[model samples]
Target: MELVKEIFQHLNGWGLTAILFIVGILEFSFGLYKKWKLNDKLVDLASILFGKLLMPVLVSYFALQLLPKVAPEYKEIFNWVPFWWGFFIICIADDLTQYWYHRLHHEIPWLWKFHRTHHSAPYMGMAMASRQGFFYTLLFPQTYVTTTLVFLGLGVPALIARGVKGLITMMAHSSIKWDKPFYDNKWLHPIAWVMERTISTPATHHAHHAAHDRDGIGHYNGNYGNMFFLWDVIFGTAKITRQYPEEYGLEEYQDDSWYSQVLYPLVKSDKPGSELAE
Candidate 1:
């Protein structure tokens, strides 16, 4: 267990980066890069640099500092638990919490402002996966939960689970459409049925990014699962279209500056009548 914790402390960030890089290559090869506008590129670049890379470190630092001071007795409380048990705990606690957190961002008006930047992109690809508002990235429930779990002595299994979740999330957002084959081939339909019910896939997640639900393929209000699709199914928010949306992003949008999108409220958009302007 000590060895596993040591390895994760060294490799967590690097492992995530390697996954992101590989997915980026696939996106580029598949021509998803052509769909990106200048603003999209700007937001993506900032998100990769700050949102995914810098923010996690800052959050972890603060969490580690604050947790010990506030709850010293709770530190390493779950260290004795077996790895598989810890992994299962994260899958339910972290993933299910994220599902509700994501769903609330759309259903609640105030939170939507923070999460809207993620849905601003007009395409589905790895680049848009991390295009989140600065505060949104920092305040994400999963981030706090995962960090807390590690502090509770589940570091090794938590890191492994996080890596698995990251891979699934990147694939779901990528333009590769890997799930399409399962939907297209009759022999593979059975696998799609089981897979879509278990974890998120490109088809299920892209529908959540659709501009509107009028297209019959879009389910903007549903399919909020980040890692596990089972949460959506259990909570009655699941939508399995087995198809991609014709368009992505909001039905109504303003040409807000990338700065405002990444660092909103701190840097309001100059565009008149924009959400960030307020």
Candidate 2:
């Protein structure tokens, strides 16, 4: 635990990228070896990695540079905040912001052009987590939030929160499905209830990735909560079937090139049936 704390404190920006890359690649490989669904969307996976690499750094830089100028009076909150409280606040805020952006990406046609890359995968995995459109990262609020917190000298705590969040997200997206045993435990009902309400579980998040489209568009891409389900629960967007989707991926979309997925928001696809081209 002490070593973990030390590493968290010492973790550099570049180091975070390296960790995500290594872990992501491993997850990608796991999906490939297991023949997990969506194996054909490797290009989409690569695009997500590129977005994570470039967009976070670019936005974080600008956010850090501009935060003080925009919210100078909030210096006390940013500077002298308690470490744990600041960590919790930032993490919750980050997830809440992400939930909104994710929902909007699905609801708004233009943003969906970029977010479609994520849903393009026919199956879920940690690697799939990175498979987002190039512009998707540009508009991600969490990156800017991290940047602001880092500039405020809360970088360590912010990174720690992100790392913890990433770990959960990665596990939640894994094909392995860790929640099965817990969910099946007859005596674990109370704990399961609390866990599902408090943090995102595989069952909860996977349901978001379900690939159907009715008022129940189980797969139409609406639910977008990250760490917490409360945002969805409170905002009237929560879905709680606790069942995984049998089929995944966009309902009826084109199989565009990875390049198209990366550049679609800016370049726009001209192909018929293409989300952006349409």
Which candidate wins on TM-score?
1
CA shift at 97, candidate 2, in angstroms? 1.0
| Local lDDT at 150 for model 1 | 86
lDDT of 1 by residue, 1-278 (tens): 67455444555567566667777898888787776888878988998889756986887676768898989999999999999999999878899888988999989998999989988888888888988888888788888888898899998898879888887898899888888889989999899899999999999999989988888999988999989999999999999979889899886653588999989989999888889999
Q: How many Å off is the CA of 45 in candidate 1?
A: 1.2
**Candidate 1 displacement at residue 271 in angstroms:** 1.8
- lDDT string for model 2 (19-77, tens) is 55665577666654353434345655566667756765677558656677887765445
Q: Pick the candidate with the highest lDDT.
A: 1
All models, RMSD in angstroms: 3.7, 3.8
Model 2 bad stretches (over 4 Å): 1-42, 63-77, 213-221
Residue 249 lDDT (model 2): 71
Instruction: Tell me the lDDT of candidate 1.
Output: 0.86
